[model samples]
Target: MPAGVLFMFIIVFTTLVAVRMNSYVISALIIYVFFSIIGAVDDIAKVINQRKIAKGLISKQDYQYKADGISAGLRLFLYMTISLLVAMAAYKYIPNINGDINLPFISIVKRFPSLPFWLFIPFMTFTIAIFANGVNFTDGFDTLATVPSICCFVFVGIISFISSNSIWSNYLLIPHIVGLQEILPLIGAVIGTLLAYLWFNSPPSTIIMGDSGSVGLGGLIGILFIFTKAGFYLPLVGFIFFMEFASVAIQIGYFKLTGKRVFLMAPIHHHFQIMMRKSGLYKGEFQIKSKIAWRFHILSVVCLVLGLALFLKIR
Candidate 1:
């Protein structure tokens, strides 16, 4: 079973209880589960295909396509459509949530600059979709995606908690988003769940979170930043995921533009793993994987600190 489905349910229960059934928390959980279900469907497809392969029902050539769960075109279509609907619903139904966003260094006297619905919907949708896939890419390594994600939620939780307080928001000069505090419990639930996941996902992993977990959690984080009015800071906080997604994009775009490739393998982590393999520096597969995972974890920690500093201290 994809632990994501169970975790999502747990998150929903814990957050609702923590917030005493806050409407915004309910709305957020619904969106989180929506994306998770999409990923779960893909995960189910892959699982069934694996069973078929084991039974010698799928040929090697056909296995590649079958193992990938849903077709890329179909997956992208769903991401775009669902993201658009979520963005529109967020804008129209969610209280105090709007297209307004926070800038890193800019200070607004009375109001933050806002985007019209026409622009905001597309922008938010893209953010959610890109991040949903970005995290899926990052999950290629054991505990690679889990630790950094925990770090990200830690930063987001702190920021959201502070932003919900008028005194702290004014003191730090961050936007005071009403009802944003309700998300703190949700973040807490997510962080707690990820921590537990990390215990199983550590180097020499027992199981993986898979697409079901990654996509749902990724989509949730994307929207969390938006609700906190810190969408601009996402790249700063989740730079590891951004790089993973970018590496693939760069590899594909560059390969088509020229005959050369950027990384040995796309997603960057795999590239690093390949580089380690070629150098013959790492003694074993376990060491190489652990080394790369640790480096990414450390980098994520650094990013979390810098992102928070810039968000809270540097004007």
Candidate 2:
């Protein structure tokens, strides 16, 4: 249902934006395709995959189902981390990559001459991945990942709007943007739909977003900023993603490197989920499962606010 609402919102946002922008038929069609189809395809695929498992068609369910409830947070985390590293490296050693959409959108601007892009990649990858995972990490339970994603996108998309127009860009002290404004409304609508989806997806989630949703969200975020081309700033925005992945990363690292397990389970959320019963965190706790999820909403909101302030100040 949460996924369905996102689909519907994408449709509405696409149609209105297309008409308002007077986009060419092809462009408008593409917009519809991206928002309506590309955005939702991952979720659909997950459903298909899960159905296969349910029907005993596929048996590889070990790690596949591990991140089910926490996928949205995880995907955005990793995609941004990897993407940021690539972008920074490209911006550094390679020749200038500036243009309309061709430019490395998110990484170090060639003109900035600040940090060497190459030098930034490792730090960027780890940091961005950590932060991105943080959002997921905070996603302890229902409505956590989806609700915050919706809010963050709305805020991030608005930044694009400020950049889209020269006047507003100047007023906001942001760069002038083109064609990106279209993405803002599209994202807004997508997230708006996601917001609606959260109504049904919150505590005791009826439908887990799974990795399909998380990774896709991260990918879309990369595309939106032209960051995918260069892989920049992922660490800054995707704080929550990195943290979640880090838990697993750390767990794996320790086990492999030191031969010890950190948490009884990885991702941290599952640890809490498991311990909740033993620790009495969920016993008659008005849906103990739900109480866990509410924690995510609060944490993501905190990360969102902090990330927004930093991004704007840095840019």
Top model by TM-score, which number? 1
Each model's total of backbone clashes: 0, 28
- Cα-based TM-score, every candidate: 0.94, 0.62
Q: Tens digits of per-residue lDDT for model 2 on 188-220?
A: 556756766677675556775543344345434
Quick one: how many clashes does candidate 1 have? 0
Tens digits of per-residue lDDT for model 1, 169-223: 9988888877878888889999999889888877667778878899888888788
> For candidate 2, what is the TM-score?
0.62
TM-score of 1: 0.94
Off by over 4 Å in 2: 1-141, 225-237, 284-286, 313-315
Q: Model 2: which ten-residue window has the lowest total lDDT? A: 96-105
